[model samples]
Target chain A: MCNERQEQDPGKFRDQIRQGKWQKSTSGACPGYVQANLVILPREFALDFTIFCLRNPQPCPIIEILDPGNPIVQEAAPDADIRTDIPKYCIFKDSKLVEERTEITNLWRDDLVTYLIGCSYTFEEALVRGGVPVKNYLQQKDPGVYISSVMCRSAGVFWGPMVVTMRPIPGHLVARTVQITSRFPKAHGAPVHIGNGEPIGITHLEKVDFGEPPVIDRGDVPVFWGCGVTPQLAAMKSKVPFMITHKPCHMFITDIKIEEMAIS
Target chain B: MCNERQEQDPGKFRDQIRQGKWQKSTSGACPGYVQANLVILPREFALDFTIFCLRNPQPCPIIEILDPGNPIVQEAAPDADIRTDIPKYCIFKDSKLVEERTEITNLWRDDLVTYLIGCSYTFEEALVRGGVPVKNYLQQKDPGVYISSVMCRSAGVFWGPMVVTMRPIPGHLVARTVQITSRFPKAHGAPVHIGNGEPIGITHLEKVDFGEPPVIDRGDVPVFWGCGVTPQLAAMKSKVPFMITHKPCHMFITDIKIEEMAIS
Candidate 1:
């Protein structure tokens, strides 16, 4: 099933996910298309969260924001429905994980505002294309995710520490890696920290908050980029009455091409 | 006085403006610093206005947003007060211009939120530095401003046509002009419509809605950039009960250097 998903058109692929025919992570699906992290909140909490994303763009780059009660993603994927297109959805009530479901049609409300944030997958692809090898991609595994000591600029009730994803890059290629990823600011842009992570409060690179342990070889520097998880953490910490997001790695694929997001 | 203003530090220049000693346009004042557009609104209208700016970044690039009830611009100018920093401000009521003043201290409210948006002066400096001539600068006059037929992507109650500032660039340097200005996305980035103004609803190059008439030579083409006036136009058209903005060409100078806003 995973093998068949590769190279499929975005719209057709969304149909497959919507119909419950595919339920795996969307990592390698539609290679050249953009995949986004989902965050749906009620209209009451929309303003602060939107401001939070605007202030902390490194961790929360908004690709498209759906109008209140609007289920269609007009900018990213015009024909797709937000409630049913993703492979999986997580419901949070009062900051606690309440349930994980395949479809959110039953829980959809008229005041819900959906935000599609850029995922690291886009920049990772750019890194590979630029001849800079990403260790986790080469190993076909998830990169290390950690809770850094750097606090995100707070917006209203949203306040929390920044979370970062780490990739092992060869020391010689760190500069080129930054240049390649910097083109796609929407996809978490440049590295927040490099070489030593201690300044950012990461004492142990081997012990990560999420994903597989990183493989850091000699002469390899652990490069860190702002992670999409920062917003989720902020949402949980803020204890908003209700919130919804895509299950980790189960992103919503958009019609936008990767090249279209490049700054140059 | 003009020579004294040039090369003067942002802090000192802001003090001069705060004391009502500098009532003229901010152009050429604090040459290397960033100048910003000011928008003040009550807390009730902040969310929608902010969302409008985020949705339409090219026209309304935000440099910093002060928290509700907080008048100090901590990010852009920490010691500066939003109510008194700019040389002049325009007051609007029910979408109509009611008054113009040097300070809003008497009208200040605890619920007001301030937004400092990027101004084109930063990019115009970049153009001059890059050897792309800006006709208005060469002529020692303000660039032409026009209300175009291009409609902005509406957010909530804010909706109106985009306003553009025109600069006649020599045909040979139009491409270079684009490359230079594109570096400052925070300050009205790339040209929205190039060469033909009629396609964007401009019938006469000699007539403009604001500022001086443009000077277009036979070999020069008119280039349009999304102007800061766009948000003000939207606010007026939306008929928001009350709003405040910097008077034309009288902008708030920030401590940030021009190079800081440039994208690599």
Candidate 2:
């Protein structure tokens, strides 16, 4: 899957996905461009969820928000359409995954508001550029994700524990990794925990909850970052009647470059 | 008033103001602690205003937001009360300044939600420490403020132009000043415009719109930062029926250290 077609232009890549010619995970789809987590909710619940993102920015850094009933992503990618850009979409009804579809034109609602959230891929690129070897990138696999006991600050009807993604780094590069990733606050920023994940309620590194189990070398330490999947977990836990999110590992590519989101 | 009393503990400093012994502006009070701009709005408009802050983070960096009908500032300072902690309060009716009082205890309502926004004093401190001499600091006066033509992203019913505060810095240290201030994104972050104010519609730096007029030295260049007063300007311009804000320069001091809010 890591072929020449993956490195093509972001808009052209979205075009392939939109045309249903490509429907796989977007892990290595478009390098250098930003990939975001998508969450669409009815206007009645949009305000509380927007506040939820503001309250817990680490897990859910917003890239851009579209006006109600608008399918065009104006800020992140003006030419992209949210309804069919992503390779796959998850439709949740009464907190249960009811169906998965290639396009959500049938489920689109006039009262729905879309939120584009920053993903860990942005910071992962920074870590790699900073000479920190990420185990997931090295193996060309998704990092392990776990639902931690750390509860996010509840906002309105949204209440749930935080979900985090884990990446093991060589012990010598832990500090440097923190410094490099800190520059992109919009993309999960710094590590929430380092050295051990016990305090966050992850007792077993081998027994994972989501994605593949991480490969930790002898001197490598497991690092955790607030995952973009957190808001989905929260929405599901709160029993939101209607919600839409990008399928796991399938993201919405944006025109924003990784450097543009960095603070320093 | 750079007296010993100014360096006292934040909680104790609030005690002085709460007891009526301190009634002056909170410029130098609790030096190392974070000072914030205050905005109290009814719960009906709370969600929109929160979204407004998230959208226009530069002009309105929210440090903490209290739950509706709650006066206790749990995150920034748990022991303080929003209704009477500040030295002064301005009451607005139909977006017009209707009354000024030392405390709003009598006008307190359960539906009000308080928002504590970041102030420029944090970044200014960093600038002073980084060898950048701010003219307003040397002259013991507040920086000049102006209503700029830069329009803020409107949220719901909130709509207005951005308000900016100007500090004259030595031409050689303009870049250094930006670097120092950029670390504190929560505190107005970096300069919006560097040299000429006319581009931002500020034709007269001498005839200031708010605060004291700045003193630009021979080799100094005027730098502008998004002012905390911006949200207030928006609220007033939108003609919000009811609002409560701290009197100009009378800020809410929090226990969080300035370094905690720095990005890198």
The lDDT leader among the candidates is 1
lDDT of 1 by residue, B51-83 (tens): 788788889998888878888888788879988
Q: CA lDDT of each candidate?
A: 0.89, 0.87
lDDT by residue for model 2 (A1-264), tens = 357656468898899999998899887667787889999998878767876887888999888888778898877888699999999999999999999999998889999989999999888877887898887875778999999999998877888888999998888899999999889888998988997889999999988899899988899999999999999998998788999999998999999898888887
- Complex DockQ per candidate: 0.49, 0.46
Highest DockQ, which number?
A: 1
Stretches of model 1 off by over 4 angstroms after superposition: A5-7, B5-7
Supply the TM-score for candidate 1.
0.96
Locate the minimum summed-lDDT window of 10 residues in model 1 chain A: A1-10
Candidate 1 true-interface contact recovery: 0.10
The regions of model 2 sitting more than 4 angstroms off are B4-7
